[model samples]
Target chain A: MTPLPDAPAAPTAPRQPARRLRRFSRAERWVHRGTAWLMGICVFTAACLYLPPLSELVGRRRLVVTVHEWSGLMLPAPLIAGMFFRALRADLSRLNRFGRHDWHWLRTVLRKRSKEGVPAGKFNAGQKLYSAFIAGAVLVMIGTGLLMWFTHLAPVLWRTGATFVHDWLALLLAAGITGHVWMASKDPEARLGMRTGSVASWWARREHSLWKPDDKD
Target chain B: MEEPRVDDAPDDPGEENERHGAPVGRRVVLGMLGLGAAGVALGSHVQDRIDAVLAEVSAKDPTGVTGLLPGGGGFRYYSVTSSVPKRNAENYRLTVGGLVDRPMTYRLADLQAMPQQRLVHDVQCVTGWRVPKTAFSGVRLSALLAASGVRPEATAIRFDCFDGAYTESLTLQQARRSDVMVALTMQDKPVTHAHGGPVRLYAAPMYFYKSAKWLSGITLTKSVEPGYWEKLGYDVDAWVGKSNGRSDDPTS
Candidate 1:
């Protein structure tokens, strides 16, 4: 997709209609989509494994287990690969910074009368928190999952503990993802931004008031 | 004169009896009924039903996913082959031959009629998981060997299963351990097919793989023969604590 310059629409025109601004770059969208696909397979196979009724219906527990394990092992691959992309690195830095407005945004966004969101950058506080949780969760799940799959590598007590942690953390992660999806549904612009790597300039101006289309690393 | 007072007395004694005796009698009856209900609830019949349900569920799950979760003694159903041929009492047979003075064949009924030894031991799998205090009852392997009269040249006993793929062996010394048996019952009930029932070997001191399931033949060999899993890199002597390079507690 061709990116438009943020220059004033036309010198002859007094005021311009809303423009499309770059939100997620092509590399960022690729990373996000790839991670989502792998995580989806992991979740589906995990359901087949953890639910007895579903296991019976599926009748290929071995295959489900193999798919779950491999997908989980590969969960961080996209993020690692995307580090080479300059745009993704820049976006990651933006996600890492937490400004005063973010804390204010988190505090006031839930209030009944707070229609206009607190000024945010390319990423908001909630998004950052979610990203942090997911990153930590993926690491923990992979560690415990490896202990379970490779029982010979650890003691019985360690393996047992791993199983316990793996099972419980999976439930929490699932709930967190559900909330993430719910929040995403509320902002179609954000979803479209992820999909097409651009968002309506007016939408960005309202949600991420501090973001500028011309800003670059 | 005394007989006149003996008539149904409506006195303090009778009132006291009425006050305490009726409720106490009712309570005793209720207590007895509660005990009876408990006995039935914890009885073999309920245990049998539980075993059946577990077997049915595990059977439906080929990968033994249920075994990964806690409960039901943590036993994973493992079979080397995709499908195992089912053996029942009417069709089941055990042949003891090879390097024996008297080759003998026994039916399910014959094995049941022999003296049975019951064992309560933990079942440890090589892949890691222990089901503690599982009960297995059957004729002792030593008894079977003695009856067949082992030949002087025989040094090991190789056991075969109706599953058609599995074979396990133990040294004559190991086989003669009082703990080893040809198991007919498990968990206080006839072993369900899912758990390898009717007749199977029980090597109490070794990893469960040594206790071959769906056992069909017993051959006395001149030397120790590695069994199914052993051929695939599992230790031939799968003693719980001493073998398999694992330091887990012994099944015994």
Candidate 2:
């Protein structure tokens, strides 16, 4: 066979050390963990309060009510405190501002299409949507919870509506949280990021290629 | 002037739509509309079914679970005893004694003969349910105490239910509240056996547990005594919002 001209050398990108990237700040991790714990208590105690079988099993309605009310009331404490952290604030802002890519990402996810080439920033569309939903749901819970606790302040119609919304939204939130836990458990890197505030650079590059670290880092 | 770059930006929905060629937005809107319609229809249907089931179950439920379920307009049927002894106008007698100068007994007809005070108040339970605007008409408990000649040292009032298993108590001040009554009729009808009838104590601001059902005895006492639930760790005071370390709003 005739010898072919030597193939031109393929252009190569510069290689960098596989260092740990700051996936979350200390404040962000703390708030996430604190919110998780408080929400867990709120959900657990609520189940004990609402479900007859669970209530009977638990057998301390008064204590459960106190815990449920207080924990639900305090659900937004960490998020409120997190407002002071610049990184967390920026992250929240990013989560709130949805772009066209978010819809595309959602469609791809729903359609069960390959996620390999989908463009996503620090948080994927699902995470951003979850954050927005959870933040709003927490506010709704707090409002309705306060109304239910201070039963006489609002009219009967308002109380009834609040109770309905509170109950249904709680079930929805529980389902969402279960799905979230399942997703987190499947991804050790994501869990590690929330726990330790850092993740492998390669993992970040692969999963969230469009992500750019904050300048202060 | 700098023109906004559109080629590489991921936010260009027009470009993305061109590539995908599917009306995903329209589909989503349609899907949401369908789901919302389904939800409304299903919600109303489910609620109707639940109401029907509750009505049926409340009518016959022995454990009081159906009654305890929220959103019943009329009085719920509840009894601590497995079988409540039914008393009518002929057989029922309420005794007023203990720490009083003049102990007396009144028949059902005698109670009906007394001045009747009608109250429309919410009945709040310790378990966080409230039945609103419940109409209870009966003789004022304060009137009974006054007639019995309560002694100066009397600090509380104890109640006994004819059920023989249930008892409740209240502080004398609580007992003498204008809203407190020995309820004979509920919802404009004679109190049914299922609803602590023949006579039931109505303590408007207190939890329902303090409103002793099938009330057969009222005793003025020297000290505040804990009632059935109170003995089982419920607050003795039993005030809707103030007692039990809870801040629930008072139904009254």
- Which candidate tops DockQ? 2
Off by over 4 Å in 2: A1-18, A113-117, A215-217, B1-252
In model 1, residue pairs whose N, Cα or C atoms come closer than 3 Å (at least 3 residues apart or on different chains), thus clashing, are none
Each predicted complex: what DockQ? 0.01, 0.05
| TM-score (C-alpha, index-matched) for candidate 1 | 0.63
lDDT of 1 by residue, A1-217 (tens): 2346764657577667567787777888999999999999999988776654455456344567778999999999999999998888766655555545455556666564453756666666677667767776787778778876776776655655565456656777889999889879998988999999888888987887766455453
Model 1 docking category:
incorrect
Single out the weakest 10-residue window by summed lDDT for candidate 1 chain A: A52-61
Candidate 2 per-residue lDDT, tens place, A1-217, comes to 2221221234353563446777788999999989999999999987766664455456445567778889888888998999999888767656654555666676776777666667777777788767766766777777777866776666544555566556666777888899899989988988888889888877887777667654452
Ten-residue region with minimum lDDT total, candidate 2 chain B: B14-23
lDDT against the true structure, each candidate: 0.74, 0.73
